[model samples]
Target: MNLEEYIKENTATFDAFLQDFLSINLTNHSAKLLEAMNYSLLNGGKRIRPLLVMAFAQNLDIKKEYYMNVALAVEFVHTYSLIHDDIMDDDDFRRGQLATHKKFDIPTAMLAGNSLLTWAFQILSDESTHPNTEVRNYLTGFLSSSSGHTGLAYGQSLDLEYQFGNKNADYKKILKMHDLKTARLFKFCTRAPFVLCNPKILLNNKKTEHLDIFGTNFGLIFQATDDLLDYRDLDKSVDLGNIMSYKNNDEVVNYCKKLAKEALASLKNLEIDSQVLTELIQFIIIRKS
Candidate 1:
């Protein structure tokens, strides 16, 4: 089975779901900043995070449209991070389009990012969104861990502080930065669906442990890919240039591939479809900037 072809088949579903969640609902006067938020959030790109949410859910036999909401919530969180990253870096373009701040103004873009970030929590906290309150709560808790002190925002803070001659920085510090900055949330993505699949909730404790392990490895692979992409774009001057301290782009990709193998191996006892999971691994290693 062609993974690309399978992705194509699922593209429409992802797109439709994205549109509904990101639809420009707030009036312009109510929050003109929302326009810029919507602009960046709705910008054309591969919806990989959301796809991961649904794909993992499907792999576990938890088939339901409710996964759509969870997936979109993940996307919203990711987009909010990107918007803030652009503003903090004073970036001009994102995915070949004007960054949120550039499209509107700095304050507007910042507010927009804030709005999206909070919206993610709102969606996740809504018990009605998913039948399994355990799943919803598990995801929300992990997201909370990933979004704040334990995750991206916390990681970003340390990264910025390191840049301004915070002399105590070291490889471990950078590694922690990568974990919280890029990897932690991905760990949340890969493992959260398992929480949703606890039919009798008998596997709750064991599955939570298993999922945590899976998420950590998955997070490493994902962060390594980001490093690889930046290393490749060295000529183009892209990448955050911190946390992922690789020797070069080739090393970054190889590291990511190796880490992905370890992560995939952790699932060997499971009965997940090999072909689909293999394709995911390929995407992790060979993705372009």
Candidate 2:
């Protein structure tokens, strides 16, 4: 199957998994909270993060069922970040729907986000994710580090500081913020599949490091693509003027293409077939939303 078809198929499967996994056992007091969590979690998006997990799993010839929980955990973490992000950004809309904080109350939205974040670790720690205690421990640690203060949280703080506090933020600072806030999760998505593979493969530091490089470049491309789209959509709040002044849209597009190529190149030395990954990189650059 082609990349679009592959993504569509996997996205549907992941959506089904999320629906079943997120099914709320309602209590009278918590029904609204559950609704708020489900409202944002079930909301539509590209599902790129989970797709990356699945795609890399496929690259390693791992069974889809084996990685479903892993993929779900990634999605939950992503969703939780979005929930909190909306509140911090005070964005009224998410995926063209009311932001969780707006749809519910701020307290409810915060709780929902907190629940999702905590549940992501729960999923990762469960035997369903991986029977190996070592693997589970590693996954838990990796997710925590990537999503915690050193990773996404740090990046978000930098983003806020850059936008609101530092009028003189340079391209390097912005790129570093994007790396932490966005790329770290993408790094996890790409690298986690290797961790889920056989223990022998997991021990191969060189191979894992190669995958990390691939993920890092891919994450950069994803963010740059977003910046390009925001510019196209005339979202002036992004404060890309300094960056854009140095590099126009065409230049940014070329940079993303370069990063995509480098990402694919990182996989070339490995034995795995990376055609799907190549297509995914292309799709990231070309996708409109």
Candidate 3:
């Protein structure tokens, strides 16, 4: 199948799975909170993280039941981050509609995000996620490190600091922020399959090291393209760790190209069919949204 066809089919399948898994029939005092959670969780997204999970696991002998929960778990944390991020950034819109905080109240949105965040761990801990307790525990710990203070959280703290404070961050610091904020989760997405399928490949194994490099570069490319797309609306006077702040559109595109090359290079020696992932890197560079 072609790239577009692959994306469409996989996205639809994953959406269905997510809908089935999160089916809610509540009418209590917390109904609104659940409503808000569903609103943002089911909100239209590219499902790129989930796609990464499936893509990496494709052609492998592992069952969907083994790795599918990893896909859902990533979206849970990702959606939670978006809801909270919209609040922190004070943005009024997400995916061309009212952000959660705007549709509901800040408290409701905050609670919804928290609920999703915890739900990710809860679902991953279930026996259905993985029969082996060790794999389930590994997935949980990995996600925590990816989304917690030393990763995305610390990156957001730096974002707020640089956006509002007097300190000036150089390009290196900005890149580090990108690694922590964006690349860490991408790393988790790409690495989860190996953890689920082959328990012997530890985090420091060569296979995982290459996967980490690919994920980190792919994430940097993804962020650069996002910055390129959103550069128009940003205040030119402020530097928000966006590569666009330091480079023009053409330059940012070139940077994405460079990162894409590194990402592809990281996959060259891996003994798996990375064709879809290779195409995905190109797709990310050119995507308008």
Candidate 4:
């Protein structure tokens, strides 16, 4: 299938999966907390991160059921990050709706975010996620490191520091922050399939290294596009003083295209058909949202 068609089909399946996976008993004492969590978890963002996991796994002949929880774990971590990020950034809206903190109280939103973060690991650790205990442990470690202090959290910290303390932050510093904050998780999304099927592939295979590099570029493209979109939304001229040092919209767009090309190139050595991944790279650059 074509990329758009593939994404449409998988997005529907993943959304349905999320609905059932996130369902909580209304009569429970923490029903309100569960409600807030569900509100944000079910928010209609393009499920790109989870889709990446599935896309990468597909090439390895992995069944969707085998990797479904892994994909969901990525989404949960992503959602948790969003909830906390909205709170920290004091953002009122997300995906064109009230952010978790705004929809619910700050404390409720915080707890929901925390709960999702914890549950990501919980899902990774569950026996139903994978038959092999070693594989589950590997995934647990991978998810933890990707979302914990050295990965997403570190990136967020750098971003906050730059926004509040380092008005003169340069392009390199900003890129490092983005890599940690954004690219690390994408790295996991793309590479974890290898870890699941054969952990040694990641350790010894050159193609696996290429996949990791692809994810790194993908993450950069995702974040750069976001910055460009934000600039467009604000009707602001491109400013070098901004977090990224792009001189104009063309520069940002060109950079995204460059990253997409690099990402596509990285898949050249893989034996599997990677048309969906190639299209995804292209889609990342052109996506409006």
Q: Find the candidate with the highest lDDT and give its number.
A: 3
* Colliding pairs, model 1: none
User: On TM-score, who's better, 1 or 2?
Assistant: 2
**Once superposed on the true structure, which residue ranges of model 2 sit more than 4 Å away at CA?**
24-30, 235-246
Question: How do the residues 1-289 of candidate 1 rate in per-residue lDDT, one tens digit apiece?
Answer: 5888767766678887666655544546356876777687778867777767777877776656566667767788888888898888788998899988988888888888888888887887786457767767777887888888778899888878775656677767767777888777777777666666663533556555555555676666676676656655665443344544435566666666777676666666454655766677668677675
Predicted model with the maximum TM-score: 3
Model 2: lDDT of residue 279: 87
Error of 1 at 252 (Å): 2.8
Could you give candidate 4's per-residue lDDT for residues 71-170 as a string of tens digits? 9889989999999999998999998899999998899999999998988888888887778888889888988888889899999888887767466678
Candidate 1, which ten residues in sequence have the lowest lDDT sum? 237-246
Q: What's the lDDT of the predicted structure labeled candidate 1?
A: 0.71
Give the per-residue lDDT digits (tens) of candidate 2, residues 1-289. Answer: 8877898899999998887776633244358888887888788968899998998898775666558888888888889889998999899999899999999999999999999899889888888888898888888999999999999989878877775747667878778877888899999998788878875666778887778878888888888888777777876656653345357888888888888877777788666577788888888888899
lDDT per residue as tens, model 3, 1-289:
9999999999998998888777742344358998998899878988999999999988566789777888998998999999999999999999999999999999999999999999999888989888899989999999999999978888777766665643577677778888888889999988889888877778557878888888888888887787777776777776665666678888888888888887787788566666789999899999978
True lDDT of residue 125, candidate 1:
74
* Ranking 2 against 3 by lDDT, winner: 3
